[model samples]
Target chain A: MDALTPHLPVLLVLTPLFGGLLAALMPRRGPAPWIWSALVTGFEVLLGLSMVKLVRQSPQETITYFIGWWPAEYGIAYEIDALNAYVILVVALLAFVSTIYAKSSVEDEIPKDRHNFFYSIWLLAISGMVGICATADTFNIYVLLEISSLTVYTLIAMGKYRDRRALTASLKYLILGSIGATFILLGIGYLLMLTGTLNMADMHEQLMLMKAEGDLAGNRTILVGFTFITVGLGLKMAMWPLHLWLPNAYTFAPSAVSALVASTATKVGVYMAFRFIFTLFGSVYDSSATLALMAFCGTLGIIVSSIRAAQATNVKKILAYSSVGQLGYIVVGFSMANESGVAASVIHILNHAVTKGAMFMACGAVVLRMGNADLKSFYGLGRRMPATMAAFTIGGLGLIGMPLTSGFISKFYLISGALHDGKWWLAMVVLAGSLISIIYVWRVLEVIYFKKPEKRAPVEEAPFTMLIAMWILASASVILGVDAELTGRLAEFAARVLIGGAT
Target chain B: MEGLGLFNYWIAVAIMMVGFYGVIAKRNLVKQAISLGLFQTGVFLFYITMSVYRAPDGTPGRAPVWEAILDGFTKDPGPYDNPLPHVLMLTAIVVGVSTLSVALAIIMNIKRLYGTVEADEISEIEEAIEHREEMMSR
Candidate 1:
């Protein structure tokens, strides 16, 4: 059992993959696929929790599993450290909740005939994301990224019911996303050509040896590879100029799809960027210029997205723009390259996932009942579905960084880190963006609670499964906000692991 | 500089430039798709060019696989065509095809709804419609 514990990371990814294939083949019975997905995801969450516990107990240890029992020198390997373990837990929890929420939400949003297919794709996407987080090999990351992205395109395209624009948005995403993946693949090829290895640990060891011997050829090639990889991953994470596809895709996708992807997809991309920047190149490169460029772009994204959010009329689009701004904050946090800065960003990965997931899921409930996600459609929603509206209100407060909510913890750490770095201007921009967030969030609140109902349209509360899931994440947002020590330690440990420390 | 020829890489770069130009300048969506294809093909060509190996006697080196099999696998495999770039490009081509197919499908849908496939025309029409709606509301 002690030996088996090290293999739990690989099982966390494989279980969902195999389950997705099996569930896809199952006959389209009544909610069977959804049930199967939930069961599989539940098991995954258990596995993730066990891994987290294992990490806490032995923070200094690294778990390496070789595929097919082949030697690590030649075969593929899965490496799990404290950093990826945290990511795995986040991905699994969001996937599980989204699956449970999708049970009724998908029924109302998607056609009946397509429900099983949607669940299957959702499982596949989760599996792919988990695989990307778990793998220690660069080539394996690219393959897993493709798997996740292809499934995402299909899932976003499934939003044809809401608007035909989803089809176009999905297509644009496919084009840009493929370009990004291809660039990453090319970059990986460049690395393999120079190093003659695909395993990240071996590559690191070899790179250090080469550096000691003053091997400029390999070093230069690796630098070029790093540049390509950074640009490629940047496009996927929606870092400014390349973020053209994000707003439309989020706005037009189905409510549940939007919620799931918003919570997890870009977060995973940011994680990949962090992994590359801090892990593979951390020791070799003085990336202050790179970090500065990222900071500049992130600040621009925050400003642009904040203004866009305020100007937008569609509730989902406003939230979508806000997501971009929130992601900008995460980017800037990491760019500071300080321990507290990276930790705050890492913690926000979880905080933002739950907060945004709750908010989007609440919006899904509103869309299900109202047939639209426009701000006007939410007039007096507080009186009708008090539970869901309350969750939305809480999520809004969290977005604006109110006290006793998850957003406050994230913003406080980010601001403190910026101040520590003496980036007072960046800190001011962060606060300014927060101020703009207040306007849009208040707009939603005013329509939902303060304004009068449009007419006597029959409305009902969100179903049990959805409300349960929303409350789960919403409560977590508040609980984590009040108790910051647990997430803070995990984030610090993750940063250390990424920077080549044992813990 | 003594023996290596840079012409192959230059040709690949030219092809890539043409493709990029097409993607930026083409009016039809399908033309843009073709342009993307061309650009990817150029990249593949560039990778192949970079991996070329020459024998000591001045002949082109064969792929390493045959030499490994024929020499009882004892000798270091002769410098061969780099299989790594080829493998990577193969995956890249598939990704390009997937993206192209999805792009074309979207173009078809856009045509079905908007009655045109020109990007500028579609934008113009949308702008005109938005303007009329704004004026009427005022």
Candidate 2:
């Protein structure tokens, strides 16, 4: 294990990539594709764990691997610190579970001939997101962002076999995502022009030097670049007002695809924004106004999206809108830019990933059994699929930030962060969002556990494979809620790293 | 003179905005994809503009190709253009092409399914379908 430490970062990306290629090459029909991708992602979970251990055990608290042995300024580098290692682990674990869940769900939704390609794109999407988390170069992030975004588009489009709206949704996302990516490219061009470096840390140093030289005050070009980046990442991460693409994309996507992408992709986008705002531009840039704007938008997003979730009759749409609301929490947390606030954001990233991933998987199970995910389909689901609904109920409680769930722990930090920052109104908004979220989650729960089906049809539980995957994530959220020490420490350490870098 | 010196940037911005307007204003899906391509091309042009290098003597830089055939490599390859942005843009162009192809493929599928590539028409069709689905559930 020690001998393999040096290659961990690149391996995290390459393993899934090559695995995806190999999965693509598998014969059009068989269990080979599913088994192969599952094995790859299972291995990825181990790689992710090892990476976390490496970053934790390291003296400097970072593992920086320069690709091709080139210096940082000249070539791309993979830098794993406390923050991204946590995210990478979340993404890998979710990908593995989603793969296991996808086996049954994909067979049900997608035609047989497309199974191999489905797994291929699934693994490729994971590779792209893992690459995004690991890379230290700004341009490399763009490339990986495109890679992941393209794969996700394809994954979402494959849902057309069941519903034609998937094509339109995928196209909508493609057009918007491409524009967002181009804006990022333009922003990076400006940064490269200013700093003459693509390495994030190098760019930070250069920006700091420029700030010291009094060259950055009222700098319009840099400001424009920052605006472009913020707006672009806003669109990508589904920040409020720019989140038009998210609901349809998530709603129309295949159940397993929704589970995987919802839990990981947007979180990675938030991670990218965190990298840029806090790490790259933190000390040198006066972004308080921007963050204030973000906080405002987040508060509004939380309320608006939660209400929308309450209004949606479709189970998938409800979860999708709730995702936007949960993301608003992270945005609000990070926008505070305080240690507690950033820590809360970091913790919520994990909390929401686990909680939402589980809930979406449960919904996938429901879709598998019922053939639709409407609220009515959930009637008496508790009795029909006791285990699935139980997992989902736990996830729901997490979404409502009830105690003994991961959501409560993050919300605890968020409210405290808000109070610490003397933003009492923000704390109130947090509570308000959680309260509104209850209405939707409660709406679903009431139907699932209480309401009787008009014409009762015997419904069996989701497949064992799907149940195992769902329960793993569900139990993870519960465990995180109970323990809270390990991830809490990691998130606190990550927050310190981010806040420490700013000064 | 200043405007002339920054002529490349003005063009990039103009082309980018033109594409952006089309992306927002145009109803056709194919047109939107084409406009997206235009928008990306503008950014690519911007990146390319950043790569142009000039010496202190105001001499235009040569291409960054190694001159090994001339004299085993010039000891002083004075004022060579920045090779990095060009390389970056090369990758960006490939990504752009891939995105375009995917977009077109999805559009093709959309046409086959909905029988139109007009965004509003498709959405209308979608709304009707959604209404039907909602009613069926009721």
Best by lDDT: 2
User: For candidate 1, lDDT tens digit of each residue in A72-189?
Assistant: 6677798888998899999999998988888887888788777678788889899999999999888889888988988898888877776766776776787678667767866776
List candidate 2 segments past 4 Å from native: B66-69
DockQ of 1: 0.35
| Per-model DockQ | 0.35, 0.87
| Clash numbers, per candidate | 0, 0
Deviation of model 1 at A122, angstroms: 1.3
lDDT over C-alpha atoms for residue B98 of model 2:
99
User: Each model's TM-score, in the order given?
Assistant: 0.93, 0.99
TM-score of chain B of each: 0.83, 0.93
Off-target runs (Cα >4 Å) in candidate 1 are A1-6, A217-220, A500-503, B1-4, B55-60, B70-77, B105-116, B121-138
What is the C-alpha lDDT profile of model 2 across A250-271, one tens digit per residue? 9989999999999999999999
* Model 1 agreement with the true structure over B79-120: per-residue lDDT tens digits: 577666666567667766776776677777778766887767
